[model samples]
Target: MYGSQLWNITSLKVRMVYTQWRKADRQVLSVSYMTNCDLLPLIAYNMPLESILDCKYISFYKFIATSANKFVSYTAKSKIFDYTSTLSKNMAHLMHKYELDIYEIVSLSKYKVKDHSYYK
Candidate 1:
């Protein structure tokens, strides 16, 4: 399958490959897989290992990291509405540091509230 198709299938495989490469410390293997699978760009950004960071994928990493931070902040805010907004502030700082697009990272989605009148 093509890299794009594999990527769309599931992120689990990508994470697994990264984990293996990390445990083995095999840069060659990682590079080979990236090149052979045609996933050089997609895999470049999401690897959590600092040793694997490349200048070519810095922007992609920034996008992923910023979006993740925003997701965490949003989840925290939703679960604890009364709490102070420190999480969001921290996320904003990280986003700024990475020069990430805040609007692109913070996507709002509508959630449906389930009716429970029958239980009453």
Candidate 2:
């Protein structure tokens, strides 16, 4: 999953990757095909691969959100349509989920500015 940060988290393409990961993990663990695919060695109900990929995306966003390069910074705020509209994890929503607001990001930081005036 190299460069997975650039991939759409909710895209169908990602589903394909996930399927492959599940299959590969089962093979590695030598488990029966019927074995629960979502379980980890000691951590049940958590998909570490998915979690890692998500963290990568978040780390990339943080880097670009405060980046000095204009184009790079713009990418932190760019919108991308999901290849599969059925899923809804777009970058903006992801940022909001992780408390990375566009206002704070565009202002070149992660701390929210409080008691600020907003002109209509």
Say which candidate scores most in lDDT.
Answer: 2
lDDT per residue, candidate 2, 40-72, as tens digits?
Answer: 533333435655665555555667766899887
- Which pairs of residues collide in model 2? none
- Candidate of highest TM-score: 2
lDDT of 1 by residue, 2-65 (tens): 2221131123665676566554543644555335332432455333332122221222323344
| lDDT for model 1 | 0.36
Model 1 error, position 9 (Å): 10
Give the true-structure RMSD of model 2.
9.2
**Candidate 1: segments with Cα more than 4 A from true spot:** 1-10, 26-99, 102-120
TM-score of 1: 0.23
